[model samples]
Target: MQLFTGLALGSVFVLLAVGLSLIFGLLTVVNFAHGAFYMLGAYAGVFFIGYLGNFWLTLAVVPFAVGAVGLGVERWLVRPLYGRGIDYPLMLTFGLAYILVEVVRILFGAEGMPFDAPDALMGAVNIGVGYFPAYRLFVIAATAVLVIAIWLFLEKTSYGLVIRAGARDSEIVRVLGIDISQVWLLVFGLGTAVAGLAGVLSAPMRSVFPDMGTTVLVEAFVVTVVGGMGSLAGAVVAGLLVGIVVSMTSLFAPAMAEVSMFALMALVLLVRPQGLFGKKGLMG
Candidate 1:
């Protein structure tokens, strides 16, 4: 059960980490505001679930809404910072994160909100060891499907090819007549949309609060570092590894569960330095 729970938790981390990886890979921007986008998604799910009266619809709508906001932020705020030093965008996103959190607090108050799973996903299922929440199993399965789809999209589509090429050399892509700027906007939006998706998926599992993003943001960073800064495969593998370590550690030592990920990260850095899947010279 603990292992299963860890995998489920890791799936959430994979969603957030992959989005972060995508943006960093394409734009070379460290978007601290990704977590804020996630928090907003959770809150949006609450509003949409009530308004639309369907969990599935909430899942579909909230990401697009948040992604649209991400597009504006990229167009006006992030796009302007391009060609400046990396620190400028990093600081901008950090400040944006704070601003988003404060705005949400003002609107929703400091209290944590409750989000419940739909009736269809409220129960548990037997799986050899014991019964586990059906929703968690759904999360695992859904994350796998989404990850596979993302992989296919990145591997098979023209846009995916552009994104891959852009990551390698945007100058050459531009010389080939591709509008790198528009791609940046789309990638940023897509990354934030992924974060929003993770947020809605996570809402029912935890309290929806302004500060909730802080912890997840930290974990996502750890995952990014451990997995490789811009490697989607690394993010997926490291997310599950970190999730399992944290979950299993809680069984024996609750105090150490939180620290286990950091410990593992330090170990990985000491050995690999560039991360398990991170390529040399890509450390930015």
Candidate 2:
């Protein structure tokens, strides 16, 4: 039961890290606003459910809403600044993240707000030694489905090939007559949608709070780094590994659970600065 719960919790990290990895992998956008996007998704889900009283609807709608916002950011904010140094994107996103969080605090208050679990998934299921929350199981299942789906999208599909090619060399892809600009928009939207999905999935598990994504963003970066930046498989493996480590360690040293990731990250960097499954020149 504990193991299952651990994996379930880690799955959220997997989802988040993938989006982060993708955004950075393709655009080198070091999106500090990533967490803000997640928080927005949760808040959007909360709002949707409150008005429509449908979890599934909110699940579908929240991602689209967030994705739309991402599209706008890509066009108006990120695109114009592309000619600038990477520092520009980093600083802009950091500022955006701060402003977004402050707006959330002002509108929603600093306290965590409640989000009801869908009645259909409100119980527990006995997995083996004990019972696990069915809702968490849904999170696990949903993420698994997403992983497989994304794997296919990136591995077996034409769009995925173009994205990968663009990741390798954006200028070359554009020279080859591909509209790399549209691809950038698509990838950014996809990343935001995934982050949004993470937020919606998280709402029932953790109350929606202004800073809910702050810690989560930091942890997602750790998971991405330990897995190897921009490596999807690495994200999945590291997410679960970190979750298990945190859970088991919290049993004895609760206060140290937070710092364990930093320690692990340092150890990993000493051995492999690029990450577990990262390619040799991906960051270059």
Which lDDT values do the candidates have, in the order given?
0.92, 0.88
In model 2, pairs of residues that clash are 228-275
Candidate 2 local lDDT, 210-239, one digit each (tens): 888898889889999999888889988998
Best by lDDT: 1
Alpha-carbon lDDT of model 1: 0.92
- For candidate 1, the TM-score is 0.98
What tens-digit string does per-residue lDDT give for candidate 1 at 1-284? 99999999999999999999989877889999988998989999988998999998998899899999999999999999998877899999999999999999998899999899989999999999999999999989988998999899899999999989988898999999999999999999999999999999999997699998888999999999999988999999998989999999999999999999999999999999888888877745
Looking at candidate 1, what is the lDDT of residue 72? 97
TM per prediction: 0.98, 0.96
Superpose all Cα atoms of candidate 1 onto the true structure and report the RMSD in Å to 1 decimal: 0.9
